[model samples]
Target: MTVRAGREFLAIPGPTTMPDEVLQAMHRPALDIYSREMVELTETLLAELSKLFATKGQSYIYIANGHGAWEATLSNVLSRGDKVLVLESGRFAIGWGSAATAMGADVEVLKGDWRRAIRPAEVEARLRQDKDHKIKAILAVQVDTASGVFNDIEAIGKVIKECGHPALFMVDTVASLGCMPFEMDKWGIDVAMSGSQKGLMTPPGLGFVAASDRAREVHKTANMRTPYWDWTEREGPEHYRKYAGTAPVHLLFALRQAVNMLLAEGLENAFLRHRLLAEAVRRAVAVWAEGQVLGFNVAEAHERSNTVTTVVMNGNDPVSLHRYCKEKCGVVLGVGIGDLQGQAFRIAHMGHVNAPMILGTLSVIEVALKALDIPHGKGGAEAAIEWLGESVGA
Candidate 1:
């Protein structure tokens, strides 16, 4: 076995590689939480974050993960017996339902297969069935990381509008934030949640929520209110009181820098880059799956996520190939989570990922597949090469 060395590439869906600019920005010594510089930095971040989310609504930053954001959003808008509709495409949707259930809310799950996205027609059907309109909120993830499925949030939003349902549209964009084209305000999304790990190109430490005035009003009248997760106190006059205590100084530093880098590249350019990068991976996998090797978990091309590609190994053990690619070739691929465990692998092309990095990952996977006697087509790598032939800086 030949040992490979250099930079060990970490290509998982979240906790993506941080840009040099963000790292450098975070390297400096911590500042006083109430310092003028800190205040300015925080203000800048909050203002710019709203733009990044494509929301003109209010934004709040928290020192937690994506799960924490879920809890905060649920607690803020729900009363004890409020009915919430969870649109399920994969694991994350179910997780949201469970969280709402635990919070003493009745959750109605509109289930879907892992291979496809949530159907707008199904959402309409459910809304139509709720003649009394008991559903208070519609919870969903724009991109489900587990199955690599991208739902049509815009179309679903349109359905909700047509139904005239009085439900808040809450979206989890932890995986899709900066990597995909998400227009929270344009799509009529009431509340949008995200984490710093995936698309912000930062180390994981922060969770963000962008809420509309209506959501804020609902939060003001919510049950089981806690001082910490309360959005009103967080947005009050005493800015330091928002965090409830001392802030995560270094993480804030990283976030400020990360958001800056994203803005520098521009959101439109970011979306285009993510789309092209994802297509390159899809081209490789589609051609490879032709010979009965590896195929995408999401069946439809339009429904697949631009952030990550979940690949099913048919009857083959994907774990073995994943290990070979990591230990032998220095590429760390993501293992399948939830139901697809041991049967599939994921390739993340979101946030700070480029053509050379993608090509490097693909080359190693092809070599490992052949070494393991895995049945696959010969030109998967070539296909990706041709896709990038035009340009990567596109």
Candidate 2:
């Protein structure tokens, strides 16, 4: 009962719809890995990545996922018994803490509600109590993908400095890198890690780790890391050492194309686009939430994420709605995770998404709600459209 004519919409938070330019950029004959063209590409990729992460310090490319990037960041700077304080706002942050635990580091978690951001005061309090500064690193995620909550990393860095804690400030920017503004050097982030699939608008095979001079110094006497994940060797002599071995040449092409597109559009316009699209999507959700059994998982609108909006269904099956939207309509919505699973669903408004795409998605969701007999307010799509018009006008 499904017809396949139009373009299939994939609205997941990561591995978003690929840009035609990026796809075409990767469509080429395989080049010699040691050739001048390939070396130039590798260098350009590193240079542009530094710009994207806003860190002038050393940045490394890895043929791995965000999780591997996590390991690289940890192993590069942390010793076996190092004590790292982790801030847990959602699943990914907790996952990082788990990695630290497995790596034999003592992890102290500062927990926060899934809906709220990390409180800087709590962080400051913890650091102040540690007068001797047993904590070696402060681990945090800029945007936790599961709960769609963003922490004020810059403010937290300020708090760390105010407390005079010498712990390294490490941030995971997997879901928020190019989609939002991340000033790594400006915020004094010792280490910043991210993946290729999210805001970078590439496929999911690459992860990045950017380190400050202080963090790189820690690597000199760090834990025993595997040959591949060791940043020292990767950052050592020879161009091939950067990737540890043969590079993911095609993925490198995609990354180069993605970074070029980002720089071409300018980061300011990119952030503004994501912000406007997120507001419009929330506007539509608010309209639909009027008298229906619908609500936003995040309580405050301002607290909501520009990356994705988690929608809660009061009396309906989120699975059924998600399935209907996928099967009946040509739209793919992200599933809720962890704490909100099955009770809620998510809509991604991140990279490579536009007004038409969001509008179409809202319309399809409205249709699915109606067909599935779920109670939802009318004119949700209209509200989104209205907001889009107003944003364009402004």
Candidate 3:
């Protein structure tokens, strides 16, 4: 008999598990979109978002997803036929490059192994080859959710500065923003974008972009901007300018609560919490990989992400295993994306997640492995518990 009946656990990389407070915050009547209270709230949220991005620059909120943020960044900073150098460490970088191409930008890619982070040396060499500084922007992601690899945006920014490249540096932190440490100004990021669903502990439908003054100057000269996605238009004194239309009332309420939670925990402490939980997950995975059929998709130890862990499976379809965990064990894991499809699965240890939640997810995965007779090493759960014992002690 199935005893796994209760609140379903979501271990997916994004649209992560939301807290009750965030949900309750959104459960109310729509506020007057132009009222004094709502106006003050909109202002406060925008200002707080700048702090979340670790920038003194302006942040624009869109009634869209990460894709909208990508388009918005491109439209406001790059004109048609402008050359952009995209560094592809995994699927998302290439996807961003494709979006640039769709906007009529000339795209050049520096490819890296999907199993490792992009190398600074490679990025520097590529920039040095651009004698005339033909590249307009360098686009990359802080973490590729697909491969569970973490790229060093700071190191890459240093490489760009050292090479004296004038190209704008754009980083996507959709999967790593609130869960990890990011400094937009210190890292020399001209523009950074993320979504609401991942580390912010809010539901999907909001896109955010934090742009530096240098990026704004580029926007003034950019010829491809639209009436809706224009940053300057969105940053006016009027409250309606924030959305270019009526605001997403409930999302704002939810985001208010979510940001409050992050600030309350302290960004550094939140990051440390994620690190501990992620380490616990890795410990469990390491024990399971002792049988050699299960291993990390990312090859390098240091390159792995603190937000999500991708497990590479041999001789088993991960999709079927994922189904078993969700349907039978009441645990929903992320299906492998892009090229890793069917061969790997991801466990997200981010956003409002704690030790009990992570331990429960791991226990269910172990159960699924045993029921499916997958050849994984033993003591996975025990290892996780022991690590948590020493790390986040009783």
Clashing pairs in 2: none
Error of 1 at 211 (Å): 0.5
- Indicate the residue-level lDDT of 207 in model 2: 92
lDDT of 3 by residue, 3-113 (tens): 469999999988999999999999999998889999989889989999999999999899989999999899999999999999988899899999999989999999788
* Model 3 poorest 10 in a row by lDDT: 385-394
Tens-place lDDT per residue, model 2, 101-153, is: 99889998997888888889999999999989899998999888888888899
| Candidate 2 structure, TM-score to reference | 0.97
Q: What's the distance in Å from true for residue 365, model 3?
A: 0.8
Higher-scoring candidate on lDDT, 1 or 3: 3
Per-model CA lDDT versus the true structure = 0.89, 0.88, 0.93
Candidate number with greatest lDDT = 3
Clashes of each: 0, 0, 0
What C-alpha lDDT does candidate 1 achieve relative to the native structure?
0.89
Instruction: Please report the candidate that would top TM-score against the real structure.
Output: 3
TM-score of each: 0.98, 0.97, 0.98
Model 1: lDDT of residue 385? 90
For model 3, what is the alpha-carbon lDDT of residue 63?
A: 94
Off by over 4 Å in 2: 1-4
Per-residue lDDT, model 3, residue 250, is 97
